[model samples]
Target: MDYGPWSLVVDAGLIGGLLLVGTLIRRWVGPAQRLMLPASVIAGFLGLLLGPRALGILPFADQLGTYASVLIAVVFACLGLGEDPHARTFGRSTAAFSAYSFAMYALQVGVGMVLAYALFVPVFGTPDGFGLLLFAGWAGGFGSAAAIGSVLGDAGWAGASSLAFTSATVGMLAGIVGGIAIANWGARRGHTDRLGRFEELPATLRTGLVPPGDREPTGIATTSASSIEPLGLQVCLVAVITVAGYGASEGIGLLFPSFSAPVFVLAFLAGLLVKGLARRTPAWQYCDQRTLKSISGVSTDVLIVCGIASITPSLVADYWVPLTLLFVTALALNLAMFRWIAPALMHGAWFEKSLFTWGWATGAVATSVALLRMVDPDLDSHTLEEFGLAYLPVAPLETASVAVTPLIVLTGLGWTIAVGWTAAGLVALVLPFVLGWTRTRRRPPDDRVEAAP
Candidate 1:
């Protein structure tokens, strides 16, 4: 048999092997455990170093980039499937959190574009729309980076994907390390009520694994494994939805030949439709949220590893100066916003809530949870609870921005539209404070805090 069709199997095996190595490194290396970096991230770097870009030792490296793109779409589809938009009501906290989150996005993109036009365009002759990589990488992480990068690439911005992925790697590291530093600083300033001790964290958490006793069942079996495994069913559901999204996207493309939407966006809509349909019938009982989350988690890990491994060294070398300037400037702005603006916007538990936002703005949601755990070990601050309520409204806007921003850039409205967005975000950021909507009251005793999604 020709090895052509089986090449992806080799890529998957390489990723899996590297992940195992990353796990072992985290387990045995004292510094790695202390840093608490995700194993997938570590594995990605390892793959990059050993792959064709560096040592030319890994045959599957070239194929991993394509895998990252597909996995990102799967991750988005699962996200839509598992999300419950109607579960939470809009309130002051919701408005505040949503506004604050959107503001961060705007500020990051706005500042990034201004700098890119002034420095990158003049110095390196980079594309005017290249500045959006800041938002794509820092706020959007690997998934957004891939989606936006692909869009930008198709729009004639060569090497956008590699540069965006590099930015995401830096942003992820910043979110983890910077968040820990901020949490420690908050503890020192008496902003944190519960300052957790490093020694008190379980070895499993530090090493990124759950002990046997700590491993709770993520989902109940809907059917006997002998008859039909739950995980396999869940995977099948995701595949069906993704295929539906592809067909829909193709149909749309036929009508609007000038515009093309990312598959992830369509996949998310498809997932929402599937989820809504399931809820109206007995099928919902078989669709476990936890199982869906697990699928997303797996997709994310694979995506991150592949995305990092796929970075082209020449691209990084070409854009090193601009990438450095963008990263440093974005990091500074995010830190400033968290330290000053976030406190004024959030009420009651400002430190904890702001810290969570800081983590997420820099990396992904997982970083937010990690930082939140530091300041509110028992999760008593209700930051997650309130954030959940806020996220229902925020997520759509976030997704829309990810989807539309590239299109806007493609249409040559890069800086002009970015400025308008920045203005809108500023309004959202400050309007709440002006209207006296900044204060958060304590939740009632009977208020039930939902688990983090």
Candidate 2:
């Protein structure tokens, strides 16, 4: 058929069509950004079903893989840019937040690993294969899962794809459910604190990613650098930071077997370091906040689009049960954390701080922001900024907690799945309030305000 060029065009058309559909779905769903799941999974499934992998009408499967790289980079950069160093400082509240976040992931991972180990040896009774390794390592990182799956698939494990698909679906759903619960809890409890007097909300993430004429210069201002070229030098700065961070993290990661922290976590810490270093450089002072804003916006959009494009529908259909369990557990945890923990830790606040915390846990910052925005559409950008920044600094700790536990595969699927259920049950019924209350008491309140200026 000699449809090489035609394949490329068709793939692009398909992706674009999916994007439009996703956008519409997002708006309809209300959060607008949360639709990344449906859009990406549906589109990816369509691609797989219709691509060379299945229908052979579009041979763009390889192309989709290439785009995944860009998606990862963009996501990492945004994550880095999103961190707020001021909020991340080792204050009592932040320290407590960090500790609690780590504990949560640790518990989940620990339970997951134990379950995996039991299932692998007793039911499956095979330890020498790549599937076992992939399953265990994947508990630490989805990337690891994908890598392991492909490796095992090559080694002739039939369910390698299913495992990878299941993990991702579970993780994403966990994120969303967890985020929503936190937001609602916060809404009910009302953890409201005004922005500190010393702080000014940031207008943008960096200088290079800003689109020209998209925003009025006077309308945005957080620092002196806010006026530089839109999407200019800042983009270079972000790219440099991202690459350097990725390299450094990867190097450190290799030193430890299960310590595969997300590259985005490293990039975020690097961005904070760069921002701090710039404080010393006169040139750094000239860096524009608009660049940050532009970079953040663009990267977010690209990542979302690419993520949707990368989804594989078959995975969702096959592994819906476990994925559903993970999501439900996350949602319950979010609520329990707020109802029991937040007030004790962040005392003297009238509003439910747990809501905000859940948003970060489940959906990361965007979902949190969406939660807040839904409550207050006029919610100032600074408030969102403050919360966004607060979330960044916790990335490393969260990654570590999630990665520490590894679950290998097993033949006894019933007992293995049972472990996951039991863990989820405990998390749902107990840990949230226990950890939340402990953190509340151990950490003293700082005079710092929680809300934005």
Candidate 3:
């Protein structure tokens, strides 16, 4: 009924409880240990089962679905503050990784269109964009889901957010479980030179706790607390960027009612603009990357919880078959690309790099990095170096896909996602080989990291 800011408080309280319980489960449970399940994932599922719509236990508000959009805007707003918008890294390894990464972004979502038309739309009378949940969730994670959900939700599909959330949760589960199994398989088959065993994985990974001596400051006090709190300064900056972006988006919509831009896209652009201008001012000294990241991380966690808990059991049951088929398709695509094709695309540290890609392809960058740490405890493969630099080129592609995906569905251009991204991926792959930037075939494993040329 009629609610106010207190509803926000109540929702926050319930989610907080769930997060605590989820954390306890991860700390004590065996399966979460094996799967490396994040607390947000567990909490969201718990909320789904116990929420008012399901068991009438946790009385959630109607505004829960909307939280994902808002939180993702915050996440996007903070990203530009810390990012180097300039195109910097483009070595051969970077090109190959970029191609592989682009393929994940493209085909994962592209194939969804094929499935929607060929199977989901016909058999289930589902909308053409129904299968887009695979890409929105699998390739982009919760933040992408929030962006996609906000778009589709505004377009009159009420259940879009829940379906997308479900897809994201499933993708995360599959990515972690499969990544672990794949890492072990590669180690056994002589694909990995690092020889990192699962048992040898750091305790912090499983428990999300660093030993006392290992703990580090989350962010620096760039500004004196007497002037302004460091974390508060970061939050204020994020909020300003978010508001500016959303205001511009609204202005654009009012000027051209036929056109609309995703708030996340605009917020990201706004953050970049704010960052650029700030670079020429004294305020640049106050903006800390770590502080910005902390804000982004908090937004992501809350967004995941809200997004996951927003799932309607009725909606899930209604589309169980198609959702299942869609998830299976995503898993199969990742398996083929990360396993069979990865070696052919890289000269060194193929497994580590590919596994890292697999993590982000199915989930997010955090998942990928964690998977990388598990396999390369010492970071000897230098896969992060390759990815950190290699990702610069394809970063725009990733952003564009997030911005355009809902439009692809809303505008009846589903075939473009299917046909266009596939062609682009093929071109990206072959062009590297054609330019002699990367080899066209897999090199024999030799336990040596190649210098990117």
Best-fitting candidate, scored by TM-score: 3
Better of 2 and 3 by TM-score: 3
lDDT by residue for model 2 (15-119), tens: 777656654554445443332344544455455556654667754545554444444444455455553445444544444444444444434444444534444
Off by over 4 Å in 2: 1-17, 28-59, 77-84, 87-99, 118-232, 236-293, 313-332, 349-351, 373-393, 399-453
| Candidate 1: regions farther than 4 A off | 1-3, 86-94, 251-258, 439-453
- Local error of candidate 1 at residue 367 (angstroms): 1.9
How would you encode candidate 1's per-residue C-alpha lDDT over 1-453 as one tens digit per residue? 344667878888989999999999988787887777888999999999999888989887355666766787888889889856567566666677777877887787777777766788888898877788888889888888888877777666767778888989999889989988988888777777777875567666677888888888876678789988988888899999888877887898899987677788899889988888889999888988888888888888888888889899988988888888899998998988887676666666778888888888887887888778878888887888888776665566668778887787777777775687678678877888887666544333123222221
TM-score against truth, every candidate? 0.90, 0.55, 0.92
CA lDDT, every model vs. true structure: 0.80, 0.46, 0.82
List pairs with backbone clashes in candidate 3.
none
Q: List the residue pairs that clash in candidate 1.
A: none
Kindly list the per-residue Cα lDDT of model 3 for residues 1-453, writing each as its tens digit: 767889999999999999999888878897887688888889888988898768878889988888888898898898878757455747676777777777777777678887887899889998777877888888888888888888888777888888988888888888888888887777777776666665677777777667798788889988778998878888888999999989998999999898777888899899889888989999798788888888888889889989888888899899899998999889989998875567767756778889999999897777887789887888988888778877776777778888876787788888778777777777776776687756544455433334333
Error of 3 at 148 (Å): 0.4
TM-score winner, 1 or 3: 3
Best by lDDT: 3
Model 1 worst lDDT run, 10 consecutive residues = 444-453
